[model samples]
Target: MSLRAILLITLQQEPGTGYDILQRFKAGLAHVWQASHQQLYRELDRMRGDGLLTCETVPQAERPDRKVYHLTAAGGEALDTWLAEPLAAGPVREPLFAKFFAWERWPADARRRELGDLHEQLTQRLATYAAIEEEWFAAPERLTPAQRAPWHTLRLGQRLTQTWREWIEEVLEEGE
Candidate 1:
């Protein structure tokens, strides 16, 4: 989903600021949608201008004023409509898979090093997915069934990483 769409989904829960949206990205959407702070802020502005969100300036005691965003009625309607539609399927564009596909030209040592690095990265990623899965199971009610896109995306990441790790193990064993 687009950043604005994700922001709309979040605003459905409560009015929130740009920083809050960024926090959500770091806390939950780090895997599914890799958006920079700049990208999110820019999208927020565009979404507000397009009448999808309403912004309110909230005064802070020690910090600068924060602009809280809420989804407009139109935004809610849009989100509901989009959620009811079918999602597009795309090819898996994994960097490690691409690297492995072109590995025939690399020296044996280089291939071994690449596989080692991939294994390390996948191991860490698996840990991340496991943590998210725990959190998802802990409070299943906080998120709507249809709005669990980030968690669903995390599951996909888990499967992909696990498969790659298994393949890496096989490759390393064959090279022995």
Candidate 2:
């Protein structure tokens, strides 16, 4: 999905300051999509120029003025259209897999260490998903069904991570 479409959906769901959108977007998909704050802010400007979103500047006594963005009617329509469209089918790309493809030169211990590191990272991600699960349960209706959306994405990540962990464990057990 284009970042523009994501931004539009977010604004349509709940209008907010650039900072608010930035944080929320990160929490939503940063683990997988990984957009920087700069990328989002810059896109916000571009969307504004294209009439997809509107900004209201609010003066603040304690800090710099804030620009909160809301999706225009056009933006909402655009998001709906994008949501209805079929998602593109693309090949999966994993840098680690690419590296490991030519990893015969790396020592066995080094490969094992890499696998251990990946396992640790996956454990941390599983913990993160547990935290999100708690929050979704606490506020049942604040967002879409966690099982249908973000949780689905998290599940994909967890499944892939666990699959790799299993493969690594098999390699170790077989004395590869």
Candidate 3:
């Protein structure tokens, strides 16, 4: 999906400043869609120009004005239409799989080292996701109705990470 659609969905959840949206990505959506601050800011500007969003500057004391964005009617309709469309399967583009395909060319020691490194990285990521999950469950009362979909996505991320970790462990045990 385009970043525009993501941004619009975010705004549909609630109006927010650019920074607020960035925080939302870091807090939860990073597990699914990764975007840099530059990309988000650029897309926000483009969305504004496209009349998909309306921005209002909120004055601040001792700081620059904050431009809060809201989804326009057109934006909401666009998001709804996009949501209703059938999804096509995107091509797989996993770097780890690509690296594994080239593993035979590496020395045996290098192959072991690569697998060890992969295991470590996956472990760390799973830890991070676990912490986010814990935080979510810690405050069930604070979660808005809008969070249900992202919560489901978070569960998928957790499951995918767990599956990858288990597969890596199996490979390591098999001396592959």
Top model by lDDT, which number? Answer: 3
Backbone clashes under 3 angstroms, per model: 0, 0, 0
Q: What's the TM-score of each model vs. the native?
A: 0.81, 0.83, 0.86
**Per-residue C-alpha lDDT of model 1 across residues 1-176, encoded as one tens digit per residue:** 67777888778888889889888776787777778888888988998899889999999899999999989998999889888988899777777677666677767898899899989998998998788778764565688876576667787889988998999999999993
Model 2: residues >4 Å from true position, as ranges?
30-32, 138-149
**Against the unseen true structure, what C-alpha lDDT does each candidate score?**
0.83, 0.77, 0.85
The TM-score of candidate 1 is: 0.81
Candidate 3 local lDDT, residue 64: 98
Of 2 and 3, the candidate ranking higher by TM-score: 3
Structure candidate 2, residue pairs in collision: none
- In TM-score terms, which candidate is top? 3
Error of 1 at 93 (Å): 1.7
After aligning candidate 3 to the native by TM-score, how far in Å is the CA of 53 from where it should be? Answer: 0.8
lDDT of 2 by residue, 1-176 (tens): 77898788678778898789777766666545656788888999999999999999999999999999989998888888998899878777777777667777878888788877887777787777667657654454565764357766766776876787788677668766
Q: After superposition, how far is residue 152 of candidate 1 from its true place, in Å?
A: 5.3
Question: Where does candidate 1 have its weakest 10-residue lDDT segment?
Answer: 132-141
Location of the lowest summed lDDT over 10 successive residues in candidate 2: 138-147
- Candidate 1: regions farther than 4 A off: 136-154
